[model samples]
Target: MESGERTLITLFEEIVNRFPHRVAITAGDQELRYRELDRRANAVARRLRESGTTDEAPVALFLPRGAELAVGLLGVLKAGAAYVPLDPDHPGDRITWTLKDTGASHVVTVPGYADLFAGSGVLPVLVGMDAEAEAPSLRGGPPGAEDLAYVIHTSGSTGLPKGVEIEHRHVVRLFDVTHPWFGFDEHDVWALFHSIAFDFSVWEFWGALLFGGRLVIMPKPVARSPRALHELLRVQGVTVLNQTASAFARLAAADDGAERPLTALRVVVFGGERLDVGRLRGWIARHGDAHPRLVNMYGITEATVHASHRPITAADLDAPGVSPIGFPLPDLVFHVLDEDGRPVAEGVAGELYLSGAGVARGYLGRTELTKERFVELADPTGGACRAYRTGDRVLALPDGDHVYLGRTDDQVKIRGYRVEPGEVEAVLLRAPEVSAAVVLAHSYGEDDVRLIAHVVSDEDPSVLAPRLGQLAAGLLPEHMRPSAYLVRTGLPLTPNGKVDKARMPAPTAETISAPVAEPDGTSAELTDTERRIALIWQAVLEVPRVGRDTDFFDLGGTSLSLLRMFQQVNSEFGTGLDITVLIEAASVAELAQRVEAARAVSPSAP
Candidate 1:
């Protein structure tokens, strides 16, 4: 790409021209080669152009994981528009707000979601239907390097999600800088495991498409199940893979019990959450580090997905408790500074500030916040430059690497998603029954961190628990939902009149919402299958008891929790459960039926 002409459209066109017959994406049994994907995307681009969407317009993609999603993303970019992906699993209210917030004039979805935006003002471009029709040519040239490519909405402390406006130049430079470390080629096959709503997907998609590699789009169920995902990696011959530490830990455990190791993999990248170094030592003992090298990265959305990369070696296993994230990319620069804006010493801990080629344009339509977080600083060259305040604390190593500590703000990471306690608290307070709410992250076991919401309300804790759970289900994403709710008439306050979080008690096992009896005030009866599943749910969901009819989601069971439950279920029943099994089973009774059917169909040895 030329200096000022680098753009997704330009780069993608080059790939299409280079490898038109190479398979670009694989979703289920359907495979789309480069030429076909380009044609499909062009069809979408034509529809958007006909819909009057101009360059740099924010286009909402409200589709699930499938071929249509891929078309919508590529098509939006082809139309010179920025795509904003919306998780279909999220509540309708949140999706509505995101569309309104972005002022999106167009929404790309399938026929299944036609009713979702019947009277909504935006023009709905149904992918399956619209892309098949004949349309007029696009109106203008492709979007430039400086134009917005995507707006990723992350958790905001102000009770809503904030859109981080990333430009094409930022993303283009990302691969340019990191391509040396990862010599990705046409022979490589990658997995689109994470949701497109998350910034991680940016790397997943571009990393494969840019280098003419095949990208396998994992189904929702397959992505959640460690065993299922490992099987897919082996069967699909996946070479390049990226995962969060929490998710990879489960995959590693699954690999341990597998009959054969996945030998096709060339590189395994870890990011999103902190790494457990001890876990890697165990993996290295089995797989060794030479073939499929381990690389740990630390990054944020504002920095266009990744900032620093640390290649893991046997020596890194003995680096004490610190997670050393190696050095920043060539195009990016990092500064560890104190609150006074002065640079801290090499070994001192301070806030991490990043600046360089990948620094985002700023928060969408939020000038005040853009000014506050994205501050101007003096470059080493003695000129002014923009830098993003990461809000994470880290200390520079003697070798110029940075070791991650923890967050310095109210923000926390749940699974791989960056969650804001204030956002969850605000959602809780939306209910008239909740007067005051506080959400905090609590660690139960190793790598089992969850959010617990403590509320001050007049209603009884038992009665309020279900109501709060239902309310949260309709207002926030699964990761943002509180696992447990603790109610109090009034919270202990400090002399300063602020709620003293130190005095508040964590939810004890007894206080957790556990079903003791049936709704009819009788003792619950469970079959053998139900009992086994109930026990698994009890451990994974952190509830003392799971009734026959207890809804898995009502208890704040997220996808990660469901994954943990599936591992135990597969171990006990030897069913190797697929996600479709859970399609009819959101409760213990329903799941037991599915489990029984699965066990009878293809039971394997435990």
Candidate 2:
């Protein structure tokens, strides 16, 4: 491709022509060669074009993660339209909101997911249903560099999701700057572990396809299980892996005592949330800095995907507080500024602002918000450009690296998903039983945070907690769901009468309402395996006692806790089990049953 031709499709096409026979994508047992992928994507593009998708128009991709998703994304771009990724696992309300916000006329999905957009007035074009179809037109070119590449919706404070419009050039610039740093090539295998709805997927998806690398599409189940993901990395010889710090923590913990879990990995890029350097000590000790480079990147969806990169070292882990975000991508301008927008002195904490080629166009349909957050500033060359005001508070080190302090706003990232606490609180207050609600990000483990909802309700705590959980499950996505519901007669207030979040009680095993069977009632006795599991839970959760009927989550167990428990179970029982097994089983008795079943089949079982 020519230097000036930097659109995603053009760059992708160059790679496709260069490596036609190369394996482009691997999902489960299926593999698609570059040539076949191009042909399939072209066919999808033609179908999208025929369905009235025009230049820069949003086309919703509601398909599950697989070869079809990869093809469908490329096809949308090829059809001269920006793709809006809708997570198939997202709540229907969220999907509906995203579809309506993007005004997408066409949706690309697989079978069984057609119902996701049934009444949304979107024309569903199912891929993989007929794979042998030919393209109606292959000569049509992709959209211009300035045209929209993708519109990613992020949590909004206004109780609705806001779409961040990123242009093709912005995406191209991101790769152009980071390509040398990552050293991606056709020999490398990248894992698409994140949901397509997230901006991180942009890096994982195009980073592989544009560089002629093999893209391994992680199934939802495999993505959730750290053990399974570790096995997949080794099995598939994955070289480049990107994960949110929360997710990486689980993976790193799962690798404890295992023979070098990620032997094939060359670079592990962390984003989405702040990297807890201390939590990754186990990983760094297992594999030193020379083999697999561990990088902590801080970014926002508004700035394409990533803005800055920091190569973490074992020594740097001891640096106090959160890991430094390091330096900005080449040509990107970052400033730590005070409330007055003036640059703060070195070592002073201030809001982070970024301006560069990677800066996104603006929010879709929200012009005022776009102007408020994305402001025009003069460049060093006396040229005017836009810069995004990242709500993150960072302290600039003398060495040029910035230490991520925390968010200046209420926005918190839970498992890499940008969540507005108010958005979740709004949903909570809608419930008839909830008189008032306050949602906050509570840290369960190191750098691991979950949404905790404190609700004031007239109903009993036991009755209201489960009802609220059910309400959240229906209205919000899994990440947004409250890990623990603390029902209070009234919200704790400070002297000023404002809800004092600091004064709020931390969720504990006793405070969190669980399905605890009556002690005098018909509670099943714990089996040996169940007894061991209960002991593990009791220690992990710090609860006085864990009964067979007690739910792990209700006992303040976060995803991180589950990973820890899973690691313990694997070590104790010598049985290979995925973390999803815990999530699926949920309760103590159910998980014990699964453990017993696995142990029963194991030849090593006593």
Question: What tens digits encode model 2's per-residue C-alpha lDDT throughout 583-602?
Answer: 55667788888888888889
Give per-residue lDDT, candidate 2, residue 443: 71
Q: Give the C-alpha lDDT of model 2.
A: 0.81
Q: Residues 281-337, candidate 1, lDDT per residue (tens digit)?
A: 778988888779999999999999999999988877886466888899999999889
Off by over 4 Å in 1: 128-137, 513-528, 536-541, 545-606
Best by lDDT: 1
Where in model 2 is the C-alpha error above 4 Å? Answer: 1-4, 129-131, 136-141, 378-384, 513-539, 542-590, 597-606
- In candidate 1, position 181 carries an lDDT of 91
**lDDT of residue 149 for candidate 2:** 89
lDDT score at residue 441, model 1, on the 0-100 scale: 86
How far out, in Å, is residue 600 in model 1? 8.5
**Candidate 1 local lDDT, residue 585:** 64
